[model samples]
Target: MPKGKRKGKFEHRRTEEKIYSSDEDAGIDMTIDNCSETSGQSDLKSAHDDAENEQEKLEEKVLEMIDALSARSNAARAGAMVSLRNALQRRHLAAVLCNQRATLADHLAKALRRGRDGERRAAAGLAPLLALQIGEEGVEEFVNEIRPELAAAAADKSASLETRTEVMSQTFTYV
Candidate 1:
């Protein structure tokens, strides 16, 4: 092709924006329409409110579970730990959980120190999850809160072999 023809083609390519004609050709709607802007803003606000409500509910449930941790029944405590572990695994509740780390760590330690094998195991399983939820800055604080009980549990031969192993393994998760 002649130089002039090549330059013209290049200029066209530079000036022309690619357009998708079909919905399948684009990932989102690219067309502009004079829809009411308030509708979009309202939708955004509604979504934000819904998310805040959901998060608040999750925090309340977790707090209830923490209270359950103090129940006299071993099964109740273990069940609470299991629920907490499942919840932490499913969602990141760092902001709420960070504030509760001390309470959570203390409850876990109490379970390890006094609860039966099953409860102890559940508490051990939850230790790392607490560390994770609290994030790096708080890991040391969390560990400090629970380390004594974890150490005692690890040394307690009366604890079931499985429970001891679980405790040992989870002890390494944050350390």
Candidate 2:
């Protein structure tokens, strides 16, 4: 996916099989669009093709991990996502990460649609990274997009405190 596509804030469901890119600048995105779902077959094919096209072992590893995460079990999916996101940034898979932005965003949007607690929190982490290249104003727009939900969420105790804290803190980042 292109970096520009994930700009601002958005939503997605978190899942073990979902593939999230680590290009997030500040964290989760808040942009809303009629994001469509893509086929698993295509995502699998894309990851496979990425591996074949890249000779760099490190880049290949990123693709390999993405493929692996795409099929991971739900019990381990959230942790797996965090690991993948961390790897994207920590391993510096800038080229592939930038290229996979669309796929990642699609998958993320789907995750948010799932409406699970874990998925939302995982999605939150991507907002910052999504708008990183777009600069602060974009980030502000992104944060403002999701602030209401975050604030309202903070008032609810059923969700994880991390979710509320992340969202509320996001308000500070944008405001």
Candidate 3:
């Protein structure tokens, strides 16, 4: 990163130094050496770490929200859970998410079983994202796990129109 000139009292370099800690600095050396012209490594690492930490904090907050909020209140808990689960897309958490892929996938299906239309759509969407992290083949596993119940749910007019549509859409991809 360029170390010169700033418009303020604090040096721009010092401001940057504080953003990426030594751990991120050291971890990025290999990438920096190989691809020297890429965006500043420190800045990328800092952004990644900040994003991961924020997700973890948010997931913790969701767990708290889930426990504190009534389960019957689908909109509230579903919103929290959807955002919490979507963090699986990050590479840093890929292994952890992959390890929990079956559980996560299963719960996603169960959410369809128990969720409102919007929540069901959100949960069904998580399957493909989890499959990308786990493996393309896991899409079959996800489909096998969820299909029976969703088929039943789709038959039920009581099911959300959106949930029925999302479940139909998922069939084309995973099945």
Each prediction's whole-model lDDT (CA): 0.87, 0.55, 0.63
lDDT value, candidate 3, whole model: 0.63
Judged by TM-score relative to the true structure, which candidate is superior, 1 or 2?
A: 1
Per-residue lDDT of candidate 2, residues 1-175 (tens digit): 7865663334333333466567354465657443445666677789998876764876676666555545445435455556666765654455666655555545444444443567556655654555463344344454445555545545656767776676556446544
By lDDT, who's the top model here? 1
lDDT of 3 by residue, 88-151 (tens): 5433345445445566665666677777787777766665666666655465675677777666
All candidates: TM-score: 0.74, 0.45, 0.52
Higher-ranked by lDDT: 1 or 3 = 1
Q: Write the residue-wise lDDT of candidate 1 on 1-175 in tens digits.
A: 8665666567988768787677648665658655689998998999999999998999899889888888889999999999999999999989878888788888998899998999999999988888878987888888888877888898899998999999988777656
TM-score, cand. 3: 0.52
The positional error of residue 4 in candidate 3, measured at the CA in angstroms, is 38
- Candidate 2: which stretches are off by over 4 Å? 1-55, 133-158, 170-175
